[model samples]
Target chain A: MNGEAPFVPDERDRALMLATQEGLPLAVRPYHALAERLGWAPEEVFARLARLHAVGVIRRIAAAPNHYALGYVANGMSVWDVDDERVDELGQWLAAQGEVSHCYRRPRALPLWRYNLFAMFHARERAEVERAVAVAAVRLAACFPGAVRAHEVLFSSRILKKTGVRLDF
Target chain B: MRERRPATLDDLDRQLLWALQDDLPLCERPFAVLATGLGVSEEEVLQRLRRYLAEGIVTRFGPFFQVERMGGAFCLAAMAVPEERFDEVTVAVGAFPQVAHNYRREHALNMWFVLAATRPEGIVETARAIENAVSLPVWLFPKEREYFVRLRLRP
Candidate 1:
């Protein structure tokens, strides 16, 4: 645990985050409908969400989809080792790729964990993901010789869960 | 030093969440569909969702879109925030509108956050902002391999 921050959500705040995370009700007056059920006034429910957003508790209220249903059948986690100085530059370049959904750098395990830069390539199949990785590897290796050392491709075996914040109140 | 209380779930709530876990209807009147399926009024369906949300049993209930489908740039990044500055660094990193969710996990590089940008530049700009705000080297750990694991809590 990082330096523990005291962030005990009040009952109302907790409810708001839960609702935002779970799913906003499909109603014309969604806030009002939700408020009516929670035994609170609609104004209060709306106000609380606004407040949470202001305080950064609830990041953004949006809808996502089940990707597999949409034909994106394959996902690959790709890792790379790039020059420390150019990691940001290369990361930005890789992030630009439409097929690459996720890109970031993680602390590498000394000696063993030499790779730092990571990009997640997703496509309709393993071959598509591999092709994307191949192109990216070539583009990245051209800049930093011996900088891009190793890469690993881990395919998703199963999806345990995809829901946001665990509500344990 | 302290007592740990176990969380409990009732059958109906479990049923409601289980119904929503995977196949949330996508339509103009999704509640109508849910109501018909559950043999309850649309208001009753809404009420159960409200109760679940209030109880903190479900964090979010809505469409889980594939980011790639929507033409967005997203990545999960982690930084080795020094123990002393962890709080400050997290706050700084969380300030970015582009950041979706951040968590503190048990690892040397503790602070982790997800960045979703409408444009590619937004990702780098966010990293720069975080680095400048925290006054520490913000390591961008993008996803190398994506294991799509659908996690569902069994009641």
Candidate 2:
């Protein structure tokens, strides 16, 4: 099964995602209601979801929050270019930082873009963020000498949408 | 810092993730409900989840909310840090509470990280802080237009 094709969602799984994504009803036994509407037993619906998750078809099923409502107003994306040998070492360290929420490495764009490290951070104020970044830079330098080359910070001005996958079932 | 690696997930792991992606049951016996539907016992469901988490198959297993909806300002920022100072730069950026995620891409402005603040001014202030700390001019690249921002893990 390791090399088998990824499990594709059938009509039933697709319908469940569509209904839930559109806006799950805020009533008691929402899943039961969803099952009723879809003409499936509640247990069966839940079971199907579990199976989907187990196969890596879905990442998680939980309440995605509205960060703005929670007072996390300022957000930005920061990237860096470090020594290839130490990139993973630095990446792991950055990922552990509370301020740095999302950290990943993607292929560089070349000539113009040569950096290879990235992280995300949210704050209540820009000044606080600046202070945090400054400290992070110093710490990173201490950990790996001459690893960081260049870095740029971009702030997201607007939020288009932050939803899960829109698969074609 | 640890080595980087991709996660290896199986069919069962994918099903669990799909279910959790939508929303975990909000009940006293949520696992029970999930297990019954999957034709497995609650213990089995929980055990597999725990194992997947331990193996780093799933980055996180909790709520992912819309920051702006909660009355917050967020932006995507990138900095041009040289390879020599990459580690130092990341450490400096990661110290802040607002910094949520950071990525390294192949670009002049390589180092990219996300910043969020409760107030609008916080955005500029944070950018400036990073600028002074890194001794590099940090360019604030706020999203002017967003065509798409969804992660389709499965192809």
Candidate 1 C-alpha lDDT tens digits along B1-155 = 00112235466555555566655432345666767876778787777676655544444565332233223456666677788876666567655766766655445656656776644566778788788787776566454434222333334
CAPRI quality band, candidate 2: incorrect
lDDT of 2 by residue, B8-86 (tens): 5566655665565555754546767777877777777777665654553443344333334223446667788898998
Candidate 1: where are CA atoms >4 Å away?
A1-11, A110-112, A167-169, B1-60, B63-155
Tell me the tens digit of each residue's lDDT in model 1 across A90-169: 77888777787756666675643577877767776779988889888887788656666677665653332344433323
Cα error, residue B82 of model 1, in Å, equals 33
User: DockQ of candidate 2?
Assistant: 0.05
- Per-model interface RMSD values are 12.7, 14.9
Clashes of each: 35, 166
Worst 10 residues of 2 chain B by lDDT: B146-155
